[model samples]
Target: MILTGMIFQFNKDSGEGLIMSSKGATNEFSASNWIDTSCEPSVGLKVSFEGSDTLINIEVLKDESISIVSDNKKYSASDEQKMEEFSSVDEYIEHFKSLGYKLAKDTDDGKVRTASLRRFLEDGHGEMIITSIDSKITVKTMVNGKEVK
Candidate 1:
């Protein structure tokens, strides 16, 4: 069976790692199981693999980078023109849902709030990363690494 999950723990020296599947199962894996040679395994890297006891034929999945900086307000007029700001997190979430995207992950740790939405396409997938802190909301949407909406 094929399992999709994220690498929650990885040891570069040992070349061993653990995958936390979307269904909440934890599976161990090693470097040999990693099929993607282009990139090294690291924590928080999404992957797909086949196995039950030990994961094999591991493949890396596309993931976008998110940066939450304090100086986010320094955006120039051009930058502001490119950005899509929302009044509230709920409003932002609803906007993506209206665009046919489903909420993939969400986290709120008292200080920071984040929501990740995704839309699967025939060729590739689209992702949106939303972050809100101190009443400041930042939204970034990408399709196969190319920024869109």
Candidate 2:
């Protein structure tokens, strides 16, 4: 869920903050260090941490179990990206499943119909969620690899 809050303190030395949530808990998160948002939090403008614990970007705080965004700098999506590198169907299923995607048995031509906890991206090449065509090449999926996605 998206957690919205007010910034109590911003420790520039650590890039972490003491955030007082609307729901009533102070969360300490590494802001500039762990996640760099286009809109930096200014004391009490209100902020959100959606889906995951790491506040990689400033997401709209909403009343939902999950949140969506086009892209964010902090969370690397290469880890969820998959191109058909299957020796066989089982291998393909297992590999993508490892990446949190489930093969659509009914739509079994070779596209990820749904993913459990994954959002696939190609950085600049393309997007993975929009295709069912089996591709032989794919970008490496890395999260916080210290390399720009």
TM-score of each: 0.44, 0.33
Which candidate gets the maximum TM-score versus the true structure?
1
TM accuracy, model 1: 0.44
lDDT of 1: 0.68
- List per-prediction Cα lDDT, in the order shown: 0.68, 0.42
Q: Which regions of candidate 1 fall more than 4 Å away from where they truly are?
A: 1-84, 146-149
List the RMSD of every prediction in angstroms.
11.2, 14.5
Clashes of each: 0, 2
lDDT per residue for candidate 2 within 36-125, as digits (tens), equals 244665544345664345555554343342234323223334444425665444554566555444332223445543221122221211
